[model samples]
Target chain A: MKIKGKTWKFGSNVNTDDIIPARYLNTIDEKELAKHCMESLDINFSKNVKRGDIIVADENFGCGSSREHAPIAIKGCGVSAVVAKSFARIFLRNSINIGLPLIEIEQTDKIKNGDEIEIDFENGILTNLSNNQSFHFSKYPEFLQNIIKNGGLMKWTAKKYIK
Target chain B: MTITEKILANHCGQKEVVPGQFIEADVDLVLANDITGPIAIEEFEKIGAKKIFSPEKIVLVPDHFTPCKDIKSAELVKILRNFARKYGVRFYEIGKVGIEHALLPEEGLTLPGQLIIGADSHTCTYGAIGAFSTGVGSTDAAAAMISGKVWLKIPSTIRFIYYGKLNKYVGGKDLILWTIGKIGVDGALYKSMEFTGETIKTLPMDDRFTMCNMAIEAGAKNGIIEPDEITFSYFKNTLNNNIQNLKSDSDAKYEKTIEIDVSKIQPQVSAPHLPSNAKDVGEYKNVKIDQVVIGSCTNGRLSDLKKAAEILKGKKVNSQVRCIIIPATQKIYKQAVDEGLFDIFLESGCVIGPPTCGPCLGGHMGVLGKGETAISTTNRNFIGRMGDTKSFVYLANPEVAAASAIKGEICHPEEIK
Candidate 1:
């Protein structure tokens, strides 16, 4: 699948705290979490993030506790894909399992915010629509790609195992 | 390859593991606490996981809500109890057992070259004794409960070579806080941190566990130290000849290697907002503290309490600073009382609670009022995490926290000691 969107930039170690503050964790609702997406880092994150936008960050994106809410909040906030220099292990697995497309770019610092971008997972390339530049990332495993294609691990697992 | 990689390689049945290889590990064990076990049990039921993958492979600890604080939490513990009985799972509801991570390794549940998954983030604590341990989501944890093998991306290894001598009052907690400051939160993301060097040999088992316990805070998959004579001695008393020597190859390759000089280090604190936003306690002097709580999976060991009790023995806690002490488990709590540590705490006017998660998870008790500041040993001081969104929590070592509690202000341990 291909995705096209504007980009939002973040620095290194953007932890679960920055995504959804711990205070909001009492609830399991997705919309409630979206309200506080990036609340600690940018109080106005909900207002600034447009639907289907992408977030590019430095290394260690989504560090901290194993809060699935962090990725759920980001996806609920209309983030289409997250292209980071690297990702925390649990967050990476959880994000992909939840059907959020997260690509690990080699040098995300070079990309600027509000830059239009096109992500082609089929070819594993992210093209900078504004600058007409492009970057490559590792290909997602076929099993993981199938899970993402099915909208999440739960959905895929349910479809395959439950039924 | 480092100690972590060497262990992972053996567990995954690989001759060797380099970066970026997806390997499925043979999960030697799985653990869950009261807070997370109920959810996992629910999911496990959904998957119809009967008899578990192996009866001996799973351990259920009724921590977090041990005292059965409220009906809701009490009900959760009940569900875990029923699940454990039905599945033949080993359950440690209360008494002698304290902290699952501490007890598991002590009981020979953890060993070198094994993979363990716990439903708590501090599950990384097991790595200090040379096991590949990491936290998992309740559903993911439930899945592993049904199938003892978990998937993984054989993480790259990072080596930390420690050198020099630590000054008095400088303990394992301070070293971890200092390391976080140097590497930033994500420095070890998706990597296994292999801590080595002569300095590590000097630290006690409890201190070593403290260092590895915070590995999760740094986004590491796990943190490990090669088992040595110190490790053997600590386990020999409990393990009954199960203690084994596990070390990395001399030529083992590491993705990255870092050298930390210990002599220059001092007491460090993670300022409000982020664990990576660290500063020496000296820099935050005079920052008025409203609360001081020490004890968590992170620093709740006997050694930590002994140090804190020594500081509070002759002095009263600052009236303005409400200090609370909650041992990680009932066993530790009993140990404290038997040692007359409770006398020191009570005389110093500190509030001691039963062995429950309490304010650590911000579920109940110890909730800070708006705009108040707390110096706590518990991990994660995010906004509103401990009570009020406006309230701030500064994470510090037990020594620094004790000193700050006595002074009613943020003060480095060195200054008071």
Candidate 2:
């Protein structure tokens, strides 16, 4: 699977609260959540973000709450994928379970905000279109990769257990 | 193997399990709150499962936005209530419900050697009871509800051993904040923080719960303490006689070991944005506070209320500060009222409320305004955690919060007197 998108960069330790504030936690509607994604950190986020945009950030992305709303909001906003130096454990699992792809790379300084990048999940390579440079990331374990391939844990579980 | 590993292996039906190895383990209890429950129930329905694996083992508490903050939140709770009624799941309603973390253990839902999962991050609080409990996402929780099982990767264990005795005003909140300060927020990512030592044994169950409750702030999968006599006594009346005490093996492997002397520690606080950004309370004495909240899953127990009441028995809160006290559970609220803690709070210009998570997650009740500053006993002082992004939150124990309320600034308990 390959994902191509423009980047929306964030700094380190961007917590879930920053991704989707608690005030908007009143509903489980993905559209409502998407409208407020990153609203607190960057008010222009929802208004400006386009479909197939990618969020790139430094370490500890999605820290703090275990609310899956953070990932739901990100995916609902039509963001294709998220690339960060690291992730809070629950957010990582939440994203995977929801079928939102997440990539972890060591050096993200070269990728600036608004840079067009393409990620090759099959090959574990991230290419920055603006710089014409490529970086490699470690592949997810075979089982997790399979789950991602199936779109999410829900789909995978339904296939494995329901029928 | 360590205690965490032992419990995981037992639940996974394996002879042994190593760190970083993913295994499917049978869940003893699954927890979900109002904010996460609706989504989890949706996911569970999508799986086309007729009924939950075991209705009795599923616990749902609507504490985050309880009393229905708005129409949207009310609608969300309505969905959860319908699902609970349809499936006969154990659901705690308002007034009876408290913070999920505090209510679960107090009701004996958490026990030693049990494998537990919750949709809320603070689910690690159950580890204080010697249970192998961790937080998971809503989808994971939904899967667990349907199958009574979820997949998890065994985490490496980090051993934290404390010695000596805690000084006045220093408590579990300080210890955890200090630990997080020493190790950055992500220092223990995907790791089990196995807390041990003579100091921990002497600490009350409330303190133990407080310590384990904030483990997530340090990026730990769980924070656990081996069941000792204190633990046994706490559960004696609640648990069955067949309860087993689990402990780490003498030769248990640990990725790292940290030792701290409680005698030398000071009352600490975590500044805004990150829990790892901690400092001694004395260092921030001049930081004036606009509000002081002494409740939440972190420090909303009876013992915490007693500590705060003791500090505010005669004095009143500073005119500039608004103090709010919320008990974690209804039982705790009754106990505080019976013990005259409520009177003390009222006399000290504090507002006492029901057993709701109110304001902890900035849900409702007492959210801060723009540029406002609050000193709270709740965990996580992340940006806009309790209100506006311009507002600041200082995380501390109940004692520090109560004292700060009287002075309208961050200070030690002794400073108030």
Please, what is the whole-model Cα lDDT of each candidate in the order they appear? 0.79, 0.91
> Using DockQ as the measure, which candidate wins?
2
TM-score of chain A of each: 0.93, 0.96
Reference-based TM-score, model 1: 0.88
| Listed models, DockQ each | 0.32, 0.80
True contacts kept of each: 0.28, 0.78
RMSD of each: 3.4, 1.3
TM-score of 2: 0.98
Interface RMSD of each: 3.4, 1.0
| Per-residue lDDT of candidate 2, residues A1-163 (tens digit) | 7889999999998999999999889888999899999988899998899999999999989989999999999989999999999999999999988888899998889999999999998899999999999999998887687777887887777776664
Off by over 4 Å in 1: A4-11, A23-57, A73-79, A106-118, A127-134, A141-163, B47-51, B65-79, B91-98, B106-108, B237-245
Backbone clashes in model 1, listed as residue pairs: B1-B253
